[model samples]
Target: MKIAIHQMNSGIDPAVNRAAMDIAIRSASNQGAHFYFAPEMSLLLDRNRERGRIHIQHESTNRHIAALCDTAREAHIWVHVGSVPVLSEDGSGRFANRTLLIDPAGQIVARYDKMHLFDVDLATGESWRESNAYAGGTHPVLAQSPLGPLGLTICYDMRFPDLYSRLAKAGARAFAMPAAFTVPTGKAHWHVLLRARAIESAAFVIAAAQSGGHEDGRETYGHSLVIDPWGEILLDMGDGEGLGFVEINLSRVDEVRAQVPVHLNRRVIPPLD
Candidate 1:
């Protein structure tokens, strides 16, 4: 299947971001891509810590999601909208970073809330506590795709190998890690971590990333990549804003698994007594 990954520089305005995404998707569709993916924070990027505290109802409604679904239907392709901030249910001033999966017919098939929160102090004197502004998701999500079973995760979840391991054990053949990774950490760990996850799980890894500077003046790592089961990079977008795509053979999953057969090499040992 041919898949396209978009690297976008989103800002505080949803209209601008949506327009940019539309152009990218149209271009990919014109190129005959069967599936397309956008990076995290695809809708809006509010760097103002104060502005982040406000939770809006319209943001969580299905309107924006419907628009992406319409795009998918018109293009007749599977579309992953990365992550968008939605209002939390309890009427509290909290939000959820959620991912929407639109099928070829423009129907939402699955939704995955980001399970990991990015809370850290950067070396450049920038600190972020995601838990303060967004509610954390408790469950792991896996969706059925035309290619096979796909594991869903966002930004910080990429750092947790166990999550991917569990998904692999549950029969996930592909993994999606959509991220708006910080420039500092992304430059150091992005490719290595993504490649490691693909190698360890022996699954295809599709990473759609945020690129360039945002409205908040924060820079993001923009190298979107697709790695095959054998850990070979199929497509790399480099350090800029654009669309990256490649044709992936889903059958390669079984081929690679037969070679190593690591999944069957598990040895259970007794714990300390």
Candidate 2:
């Protein structure tokens, strides 16, 4: 099925982001896309810790989330919202960076909160303290969809291979690694990391990314991508801020796995101990 990977440069305004997404959804649906995959933080991209602290709301009550779900239902297509910043269930006043799987009926069938919090202090003097504002999720989600089984992951989670392997073993045929990757790290590791994940797991990888400069003065590396199971890049949206589409071939998952058999070749560390 055709999947539209929507790359966006969302700012602090939820309304503007939603409007852009709405247009993309309609355009993708018109082009016969079965699914729409939006970049992480598709609703808003505010780097001001103080502002973001006040901006997040519970998913059930968040109008931005409701609006996106409505768009999915109206378009009659599945949508993988890379994530939404929401109130954590613990009620610690911290939010969760959560990914939701909205079916064609606009019902949320699965949700994956990002487990890894980005807490890096960059050499360029850029520092992020995601843990201060958001709580990390413990569980991994491998969701079953009409198109295929998808292993859901957020930006920082892409750096971990064990999660992808676990999802692959759980019968996931495709992986979603939506991200709002910073320009520096993205230019250095994005493609290689994604390709490695696909090659190791023998699963298709679809990554929708946030692009361009945002209201917070933070620049993100776009290059939204789709990679085959064989690690070949099938599509790259480049640095532009727009929605792009690609055809997902599930058969390649099996074909590449059969050829490499990395899944079966994994050896036990201490004689299966």
Candidate 3:
């Protein structure tokens, strides 16, 4: 299947980001891509909670998201919106880093809230407390796509293999790991971790990432990658912001699984007795 990945350097403005996505979606559809993938926080990437709160709205009322859905419908292409920050239904006043999968008909088919929040104090003197502003989701999300069943995850959730394993075992042959990674950690762990996830799960890993510096004065590692079940890199958009297209073979999932059979061999390990 041909898929388009958008590597973005999103800013604090949701409208601006939506415009970028609109153009990319049309371009991808024109190029005959079956799906268009975008990075996490594709709508807005503001660190200033006070300043960003105004743009963050309930999904029902978020104009930017609605616009993207309309664009997806017009383009007649499936869209994997890596993620967006939206008001949670829990009434906790915190947002959810949510991923929305829009079908070719422009209807939302699946939604996955990021399960793991990034709350780290990096050695680079950059500190992040995602849990402070966003509530983590409790369940794994697996959605059906033209490419097959896809496991949905965002950013920090990629660090937790159990989530991937659960989805893979539940019949997911592809994974979407959208991220806006800090430069330091991204440099150190990005490629290796993604490759590991693909190899272990024996599934395709499509990671659309935020790249370069942002309006919030933060820099992101932009090496968006598409890895095969054999841990081979198919396409790597290195630190550039734009659209990239690649064709993925669904048969490769079966080919790799037949050879290694990790799913068949997997056994639950009990905690220390």
Q: Write the per-residue lDDT of candidate 2 for residues 159-222, one digit (tens) a residue.
A: 9888998898888899989999999999899999999998889989999999988888999999
**TM-score leaderboard ranking:** 3, 2, 1
lDDT of 1 by residue, 142-243 (tens): 899976999989989999988998899889999988899998898899999999999888899999998887788898988898999899999889788888
Return the lDDT, model 2, position 81: 88
Per-residue lDDT, model 3, residue 171, is 97
Q: Is candidate 1 or candidate 2 better by TM-score?
A: 2
Candidate 1 lands at a TM-score of 0.94
Each prediction's total of clashing residue pairs, residues at least 3 apart in sequence or on different chains, is 0, 0, 0
The local lDDT score (0 to 100) that residue 36 gets in candidate 2 is: 90
Position 181, candidate 3: lDDT? 91
The digit string of per-residue lDDT tens for model 3 on 1-273 reads: 899999999999999999999999999999999999999999999999999999999999998889888999999999999999999999999999999999989899999999999999988788999999899998999999998999999999989998998999899999999999999999899999999999999999999999998999999999999999999999999987999999999999999999999999999999998
Off by over 4 Å in 3: none
